[model samples]
Target: MQGISMSNTMQRRQFSVLACVFQSIFVALFAIFGEFHNHEEDKHNRVHANYPMFQDIHTMINDAGRSLVVHCFGAYFGLAAAKVCHRQNTMVVDDDESSGHSSELFAMLAKAACTTATFMLSSLADHLGRFNMAHIQSSSLAGGIAIGAFANVILYPHHAIVVGAAAALISVVGHPKILEKRLSIQDTCGAHSLHGLPSLLAGFLSALFVLLYEPSEYGPNFVEQYSAIYPQWKGSGQPGAHRDLRTQSFFQLAGLGLTFLTAIFGGLFCGWVMNWSLLNQVQPKPSYEDASYYLNAEFSLFGNIDNSGHGLGSSNTSIHKCGRIDYRPLDIEAALRAVKRAGIGPDAIF
Candidate 1:
């Protein structure tokens, strides 16, 4: 059983590495061929026309920081997609004003706070007032995932908070009890709860915001601010002509759906390749245990070594150490037997 488990673990590790590499390659290819928004194209043309001498410098200064910050924060892929759809200039009416930045920051902070708070409360209720440290730690970042779609477009900080709280409740209450159980899926790392579901919720919120968007809110600069959203009215200089809210909403939802489909198909294909017999042949022994790969002289729980490199002068050497308790290689068998004798189940013994 242990050998089988180890083999599966090694296979999973290999699959993960290969999947990431292939996915990155595919994403890079897509980015190269992808269409740019009208505003983005116009901006590019303007940079080339006016800033010919410092075009490269402008690109480095303006674009590099945003990429670096997103990567550094390890933002979810879905969130990054949302950012691409609703760029800063289009998302905020007064991009030049400090109020715009302040509003965006406040929305982000509010969402994070709401998500963390809601997760803690829900967890406490679910666990009968006991908190799971792992869940708590992960929940702290769930808000960022939840708010990513509408982070820039959120009109009110409280709206961000509502989105965050809803995301947390869905993750805590719906994920384990409903999604996983009904679908018979095992989410070992809680990726669905932490990233997947929250991001989907964010996308929904983003679509809702798009539907609620009004051109009048931006006053005279509506065309300049929302050129990406309403590209047809860009050069026409008509702030009166508005983009159809339904059309924009449909596109937003469609993007989310396409992102999910691509991810799913890509993962399935990579997994299929990973399961080939040639790839599965090299299974590492003692797979899950760090002792197989690491040779550090860390503290052991089985026993303490004396100056003569012997475990309390006993011939039976220590396999590992566990706190103050000492267990010899031979004693492990006896301990298992003792545990069995005491009516302890195999799960408890292990």
Candidate 2:
């Protein structure tokens, strides 16, 4: 069982990496398509005319891929953090069986619907001023995460659309307030809304879906569609087994619970590790800053300068460029005295 679990973990990681690669490819193709589609409009459009297709490509890639990929990584870690309880009679569900036209429809429609809804819901942030652009941009993708577990199970296209829109609205509007006011936790990246809460919601929805599934929805191949639930109705020459709905629901809830526990404890432990003195010594002074992480940092022209012809030079060392300051070493001192004489006071320098 341990080996089996390890195998599953490796497989899931590989699958996630593959999905990210595909998302990048899709972003490139769609960006080019959008660029061509707007070629004529670009010539006449003054607004964002300078924004080229490369920017659009990155926007599409980040908007579409980041939230989804993050949700997947969080969910995987959450599940791995806890032990899952399964009924003895429960059947194994093959992950590959879920690929079909329904899956495609779910992906495309959910993305479109979520994108539209997020735009509308983000206005709430402007009014409340509780969050910033990170929340607005990333939290909107919660719709995709909310429908993740049951994406294929949604039979009607309209239902998927509704789910996506509703999820986006809830995430963008609720996440910041809850994090700031209720939890007293400031999620700098809005990960709680973009990945965690939406995923939990998706798991609950998936459980509801299992309870509400009907044979009439999928027709003759319905049993095969959910062979993991009804083991006894195996199609073709496959061995038959059976699982009751009640047990299925219990297992689903158990999985969700385990994931929650795992995520909480795992996160706490990781945070503790990050805060340790040993780790802190090696890291940059200020946390969550890009300056320390950059391989080649460029200093801005601001500050670290003096007009006295002697200052920190281009070689990062002090140099007397014009030697004018050496002749008048007290030039600045005299100026400050003059300012005081003029009644501006010492605070004038500040």
Candidate 3:
């Protein structure tokens, strides 16, 4: 999604923003939410952090296992982005004969390993030796985000590592600078780099894996093992009725394409709504500047406030003492010269 300029009066419309959020949530819950298979409904009975049964939930609570909270919230944000276009059953699957304790263990370990790999690579990509705390924190979770597409079906931990590394590479290379310039759109938060691109990569990876799936490798009960992917096998009571890999792969790709389409159109519609005169108030004269909306911002930076909450102390060279507070625009050339004198590269500061 493209970033929109913030209005100077946005803070005053807080209630309206809150109401819109609630309305979206309501629509999602009531209008679009649908039935999905539970995690324990498959043959293998494999249990993971994402899908604990009722008894397991109780046990986790008694044991003070907070992992569930992290897993659920992480999965929520990752799944939320694509849930509008895909079915829950197809996205995730229950355990079957092909899966076991080893599979469950590897799945959890894969997520951790992938997350760590992505975090390290992303940090390095941002700065060779120094870590940007914000990018590191956000990029660390890209593995878990990408792995959700085939967490259960991934047979090996090394494959998960590869996927995570690829996600990190895509995110770092496709940073907002490249995307914004190429697309001619502002992306203030780097959503496309952090979330959108990685998820799209995962979708394509899922289709590739589906095409590569081998029934013989899954053993005699492959139908039961992959029933979620080929739902026709759920109760067909047949061995090879609906085992078409190409067809499944096509559907997977189709679902992914549809998801991007919906997100683009839906985002555009919302942006249009937000631009309505009644919704958007006074536009921020200087885009992306907090000073446009923040009162006494210049004063807060260099002086103490008086009882009336105004700056009382003397102003600095960077600020002008007008009838009210007036901030001098930043001196980019002077700042660059200072940075050079300090032996710090301009790229580091930027």
Candidate 2 displacement at residue 31 in angstroms: 31
Clashing pairs in 3: 44-96
lDDT of 2 by residue, 147-250 (tens): 76666566555556566766776677665545434444434445666777677677666667767766445544455544533333324235443345555555
- What is the per-residue lDDT of model 1 for residues 1-350, given as tens digits with 9 covering 90 to 100? 97776666555455335634564565566556543233432332221212222232221111111211232122333333322222223222322212245554555555543334543444344423443443454555666777765565554445655566576666665445233344433333466667777766766666688767565454354555455334433243665544366766665566555555555554555555655677644223222233323432333333333333332223454443333333334344544544454565878636
Error of 2 at 286 (Å): 3.0
Candidate 3 per-residue lDDT, tens place, 1-350, comes to 11222332343244334634554464456434432323424457552334333332222121112212233322323323322322234212312213346654555555543344444443344422333333444455666656666665665445666676677767666663553344434444556666676777766777688766564444455556665435533243655555366766665566555555555655555556655669655333333344344433344332232333222222333453333556444444544544454576757756
The number of the candidate with the highest TM-score is 3
Better of 2 and 3 by TM-score: 3
Give the Cα-based TM-score of candidate 3 against the true structure.
0.50
lDDT of each: 0.46, 0.47, 0.48
Model 3 bad stretches (over 4 Å): 1-116, 119-129, 132-134, 233-243, 286-350
- After superposition, the stretches of candidate 2 with alpha carbons farther than 4 Å from their true spots are 1-114, 128-132, 177-186, 228-240, 282-285, 295-350
TM-score of 1: 0.49
Each model's TM-score, in the order given? 0.49, 0.50, 0.50
Give RMSD to native, each candidate. Answer: 21.0, 22.5, 21.1
Lowest-sum lDDT 10-residue window in model 3: 58-67
